[model samples]
Target: MRRFLDKLYLVSGALAAIFTVGVLVAVTMSIVTRQLGVHIGGLNAYAGYSMAAAGFLALAHTFKSGEHIRVTLILSSLPAKGRMRLDLCALVIACIIAGNLCWFSFKLVLDSYAYNDISTSDDATPLWIPQISMAVGTLIFFIAILDETIRRYKGIPETIQSEEAHYE
Candidate 1:
């Protein structure tokens, strides 16, 4: 299970990286085409979509990697048991918020699909297509949070922080 989750995070990260590259490629192509006196409709929208995908898809991987911002000063000051309780509380709250986000994001996609919404841009791309990334990313992120909460409940460390070693 650990291996599978790790692979999932890595794969998501890789996809995010690919989308980042897609954004770059889109922008470059747009510029090149414009230089060549060709008008490409919706390059901006394509780039925006790729950028959103990249950001959304990277969420779970970044959180698992201990790269996400955290307010550890208070946690650092607490005793082990106190810290454990506090961490658990924090995780619970995060899980709730993330779960809500995931639910709403999926709902947004469904709503878009039901409405047959399309971008107003010349591309007329379906909005739900782009929204899928946000929904999936939010779901994965919620899973990651729940995973950490379980680990913490089991007395396992939550995230591996190199800063802990660096400080010692």
Candidate 2:
């Protein structure tokens, strides 16, 4: 299960990178077409979509990597036991927030699909198509937070420092 979860996070991160590249491609194509006196209706919209996807998809991986910002000023000041307790409390709160976000994001996607919502852009893109990424990303992020919460509850040492060290 650990291996599978890790792989899931890795895959999500890779997808985020791909979407980032997609944004670049879309913007570049838009620029080139405009310079050639051709107006592409959807390139800008596509770029915006890709940018959003990249941001959303990167969330779980970033959190897992400990790349998300932390208030170390307070955490670091605490003793080991106190810090662990505080960290656990924080993780629980984060889980609640992430879970709510995941639920709402998925609900939004479903609502958009049900309503046949289309973007007002010239391309008339289906909103659900782009919203799927947000839903999936939020779900993954919630899972990651829950996983951490469980690990902490079980008294498992955090791997964040080691993971960061490995990268360095």
Candidate 3:
């Protein structure tokens, strides 16, 4: 199960990288088309969608790897026991927030699908197409938070380091 979850994060991260590249490619193509006097409708909107997907899909992997920005100054000052306790508390709060985000994101995807919502852009892209990626990312991020919370509750040491030296 651990391996599976890790693989999921890795895959999500890779997909995000792909989407990020897609954004660059789209913009480049748009520029090339403009240079050639070829009109491409909705290029900007497509690039926007790619950017959204890239950001959303990277969330879980970033969080798991401790790459997300965190204020560790207080944690660093605490004793081992105190730090552990505070970390667990923070994880619990994060889980709650991530859970709420996942629920609403999923609902947004469902509502978009049910309403047959389409973007107002020239491409008329279906909104659910992008919403699905957002919802999946949120769900995985929630899972990652819950996983860390469970590990902490079980007295397992976290991989996140509070020491300044660990930053390098």
Candidate 4:
């Protein structure tokens, strides 16, 4: 089961990396095109969309790796047991908050799809596309947080270790 979850995280991270590359490629092409005195009508819109997707897709993996910003000044001052307790508390709160975010984001995506929402840009890209990716990222982040919470509850050491592991 841990392997399966690890695989899922890897897949999601790969998707995000691919999407990030897509955005970078699109931007590079856009720059070249503009240099050649060409105005690509949809390149800007597409790059924006790709960036949004990449950010959303990477969120879950980022959270899992403790790559999210956190206030550690106070938490870091605690003893080992106290820090562990705080970490557990933080994970539980994150599970609750990220869970709600995931639920609401999923519903938002569905609502956008139902409305057939589209960008007002000339590209008229479907808004649901990015929203869907963002929702998936949020959902995955919640699941990862739940796993972390379980690990913390189960007294899994190193579940939240390293100062650099605290945030991305």
Candidate 5:
């Protein structure tokens, strides 16, 4: 499970980087094209799509890396039992929300695939590509949340401990 989650993190991070680069390149090219008075493409729309991909796809990996923000003020002052209990409750809620997101995204991917959907832009990029990224990332994020919930239940003292146990 740890291995799978790690792979998901790596994949999502890679995809996010790709999207970020795409956004940069697209914007620059669009600027150059407009300045030179040439018909290049829809720069704004393409960048929007790439940004969406990067932002949504990086969510799960970010959560897995403990990069997600939390109101740790109260959590930090609580006793161990209370903290763990609150963590468990938060995880449960996250799982439910992420699970729903995955379900809806899966259906979206299916619908797009069924209709052979394409964006109504000059590029006409296939819609499934983005949907798949969103769906998979959300699913992996939920899995990471579930993993953390289990670890909290098991009293994980630090991320280093989880890393060591993950390999051993």
Candidate 6:
């Protein structure tokens, strides 16, 4: 299960990187086409979509990597038991928030699909197509948070411990 979860996060991170490259590609094409006196209808919209995908998809991996910002000063100041309790509390709250976001994101995707919603841009892209990434990303992030919560509850060391070690 650990291996699978790790792979999941790695894959999510890779997809996020791909989407980031997608944003670059879309924007570059938009600029180049304009320079060539050609107007591409949906480049801006594509770039926006890719940016959203990249941001959403990167969440789980970033959290797992300990790259997300933290108030380490407070956490590091605490004794081990106190720190664990605080971390567990934070993880529980995060789990709830991420779960809510995941549910709502999927709901939004379903609603869009049901309504046959389309993008406002010239691309007329189906909204659900892009929304899937948000839904999936949020789902993965929720899973990651829940996993960590369980691990912490079981008295396992925090995933960020290794990263925190560098500062000591």
Top of the candidates by lDDT: 6
Between prediction 1 and prediction 2, the one with superior lDDT is 2
* Two-way TM-score contest, 1 vs 5, winner: 1
lDDT tens per residue, model 1, 116-165: 99999989999999999999989888988899899989888866774576
lDDT of each: 0.92, 0.93, 0.91, 0.84, 0.80, 0.94
Kindly provide the TM-score of model 3 when superposed on the true structure, using C-alpha atoms. Answer: 0.95
Best model per TM-score: 6
Off by over 4 Å in 1: 162-168
Tens digit of per-residue lDDT, candidate 3, span 1-168: 999999999999999999999999999999999999999998988999999989989999988887888898898899999998998999999999999999999999999999999999988988999888889989999999999899999998875654465757
- Per-residue lDDT tens digits for candidate 4, residues 64-163, read 6767787888778999899989988988998999999999999998898999999887788778887888899888888888988898789887544566
lDDT of 6 by residue, 36-71 (tens): 999989899999999999999999999999888888
Q: Indicate whether candidate 4 or candidate 5 has the larger TM-score.
A: 4
For candidate 2, the TM-score is 0.95
**All candidates' TM-scores?**
0.95, 0.95, 0.95, 0.88, 0.85, 0.96
- Which digits, one per residue and each the tens of the lDDT, describe model 5 over residues 1-168? 778778878898889989999999899999899889998656777898888889888887777766676777787789988987887898889889888988898899999999999988887778887678777777777777777778877887435323334458
Candidate 6: RMSD to truth: 1.3
RMSD of each: 1.4, 2.0, 1.3, 2.7, 4.8, 1.3
| Descending-lDDT candidate ranking | 6, 2, 1, 3, 4, 5
Which pairs of residues have clashing backbones in candidate 4? 67-167, 67-168, 68-167, 68-168
Candidate 1 RMSD computed on C-alpha atoms after optimal superposition onto the true structure: 1.4
Candidate 2 backbone overlaps, count: 0
Off by over 4 Å in 6: 162-164
* Each model's total of backbone clashes: 0, 0, 0, 4, 0, 0
lDDT of 2 by residue, 1-168 (tens): 999999999999999999999999999999899899999898989999999999999999999998887777777789999999999999999999999999999999999999999999999999999999999999999999999999999999886874335568
